[model samples]
Target: MRFCILGLVEVQDERSGLRVLPTGAKQRALLAALVVKAGHEISARRLIDELWGGHPPANAANALQIHVARLRRLLSGPAERDADQPERRPWIETTGHGYALRLSPAETDAARFQHLTDQGRRALLHDPGQAGELLGQALSLWRGPALQGSVLGDICADEATRLDEHRLAALEMRYDAYLRTGRHGEITGELVDLTLQHPTRERFYDLLMVALYRCGRQAEALAVYERARTRMRHELGVEPGPALRELMRRILHHDPALARTPGPRPADPSQPRATPAPADDAALSLGDEMARLHRRIERLQREQDQLLRCFRELTASAAQRDMSVNWEGS
Candidate 1:
């Protein structure tokens, strides 16, 4: 039997291919909370607060008992269906102060998703193709939002947010693996979808820019950087990070390394890949770019001085004209 909270809170019976779940909102919430801390007891106080929105009824204990009983019956009833399957029968356990669900990571999609994502991320430098496959498997497990359908309590909401973040990170890792394996062109459309879905996520823009440039759309790649810069500044009220800015600079220079396909390298696990040795030519190019920037900044300062002078002249003339009109009237 598998208890799934990756999407809806439900139970899937392996033998009968039957799907059963809690129907009421509170019941579903209870099941979700328990499943989040599966195999461990969650305090009755916390469960009560979550189940009742921090304002449980006068007889909250009895009400909780009713919900628990219903869930137990829902999970374990129809004795005939589970007579041969003892494991499928009786999943929820009552504790001295709280409740626990007798479940393991093998039977939980959420656990499996996190586990696979971790494995995929670790395999990135050593085996990108295999990493992509593992990450793809992890991503496929998400049916929708974590703990879908139930009114998310604090515990559930936090878990859901954490899971969603892992999902996004896994996606970035998987696509990064694809790029490392030189399959950028094939994933442009999918990356576009991800960019649209997560416009504020600069990693997607970084990936898109590389993919576009590799597809011989250098101009489009630069355009993607511009869009990211504008959106980041306007919406996020900040500039793109240094890594993204460097990527843009590399694209502008048509960095040969960006175009070259990267080969699989052994991962260290203890240390990050070392930065490439700096090139003198790159330093010279950077000097030129910096010189141009300084020139542009100086020009802008001069323009600001000119605008200030113009504003002062206009103010003085207006004042003089007003004074002359007053004298004529007098």
Candidate 2:
């Protein structure tokens, strides 16, 4: 049998590809914990603690034994059992004070994912091209949220959070590889969505601005900075950090620094200056100022229109009242 734990927890038969394990909540939790901590022996007492969180029933040990027995029976097929004691067989091995799921490292998807991620990271440090492919392989192992159909308590919740962060790190590494290969334009949409989902991650915002600038959308890159700056100030009551501010400065000055190295760097303390001819710099600055003024004008125009509408309604009501009074006088 094989265990799938990159997403939902499931146990499948190797030959028939059928899920032989029970789908009960407790059973699924038990399987999830085992998969996350694979190749290690988890004590029954620890299992009970995880399942019940220190409020176990009086017969908790007996209940756990029954559950383990059920899981073993489901995993053990008829071909492996003797006719004399078919119902009392054990598939989970008994250790000194715990039970261990007997499976090879290759039988678990979580294990495979971690292996591929490690290989990918190593490859990234050596060859970015090969690293992208390895990272892609690692990402493909995730079917959805880790342990998606299982009941997650404290331990499982922490494991799930760690797995999610690992996945994000892998994605960032893959995007780095893409940027190294000059595929920034192709990744702009994905980076945009990521920024929307995680608005506070400065690295994603930096990548997005770089992608936009590289794609010859300098104006859009500036807009991205404005948005990120606004979000940071509104949500966190602070301006963009040094790294993001440096990126914005580069964009504003049209500095060659925008296309420098692929890795992250600390913000240079010196102020950036426009490198183009004086006439060109003047034109770019004029255009930027015009855009800013146009935005302010639009906002004022909207407010003026609302005020005019209200005034016209009040004037019509006053006119109607005067006509009624004149009719009554006649």
Candidate 3:
């Protein structure tokens, strides 16, 4: 059987693909809590608390037992066991203190998604192309917000937050891989949307700037940085981080290192691949010298603006003095 919690809570029989979801809200909540933390035994009191929040019914324990029994029967199927048929093991086992729901890693999409994202991240530094593929697969599993169907108790809410965090991390990693592989032109639009959605995240701004700069949209890249700075200052009362500032400096000077490199050729799956040479920090640190230069440029520009204003004032004052002198002579 496979359980889905990415969107609605659903349990599908592996053989028939039939959905066997509990009808009642409390039953569904109980199931959701167990499924999210599947493989661990949840105490009876904890399950009761999740189902009823602060106030539980006088017969809450009895009600929980009834729900557990119904779920067990549904999972076991309706076929009558005969003398010839082997004894069926229970899916929901009764523990000493509470109940535990046993499910394989493949049975739940959330677990599978986590597994794939972890694997993808591990391979990210060495095999970014493969990492992108795996992370993409992990993201595709989510149809909407996690556990959209059931009311979220504390446990369910925590699980949802954890899954969402993983989802965002995977997306960021995939985009980083895409940028590294010279797909800047393609990712710029999506990065624009991501920046709008998560303006506080400096990494998204950095990636967007890089993509725009690489695509010959240098002015737009600078504009993005300005927007980020404004948003950050207005919202968080802080400036953009160092990496993003460094990237801005690079774009200002038209750094050739910002130009995209030809991505590595796709390796054959059957062949044992040689290790790639350690990559240079050119893409990352090429702007170290430029950072100081950019700071100086900004200081000079400010000074120039002050000088120009002083010059204009002095010229106006001299004209007035000449007019006064001519009138006095007359």
The candidate that achieves the highest TM-score relative to the unseen native structure: 1
Quantify how close model 3 is to the true structure by its C-alpha RMSD in Å: 10.8
Q: Compared with the true structure, what per-residue lDDT tens digits does model 1 show for residues 199-310?
A: 8999999999888777766666666777787788788898789998899779777698988657666556897643422335644565456546646976997999999999
Error of 1 at 235 (Å): 2.4
Best by lDDT: 1
Alpha-carbon deviation at 44 in model 1, angstroms:
1.9
lDDT of 3 by residue, 8-89 (tens): 7877765655777777777677778888778899999998888888888999889889889987886676222312333434
Q: Candidates ranked by TM-score, best first?
A: 1, 3, 2
Query: Model 3 misses residue 295 by how many Å?
Result: 8.8
Q: For every model shown, what is its TM-score relative to the native structure?
A: 0.79, 0.71, 0.73
* CA lDDT, candidate 1, residue 24: 79
- In angstroms, give how far residue 9 of model 2 lies from its true place: 0.6
Candidate 3, which ten residues in sequence have the lowest lDDT sum? 78-87
Poorest 10 consecutive residues by lDDT, candidate 2:
273-282
Off by over 4 Å in 3: 78-88, 262-330
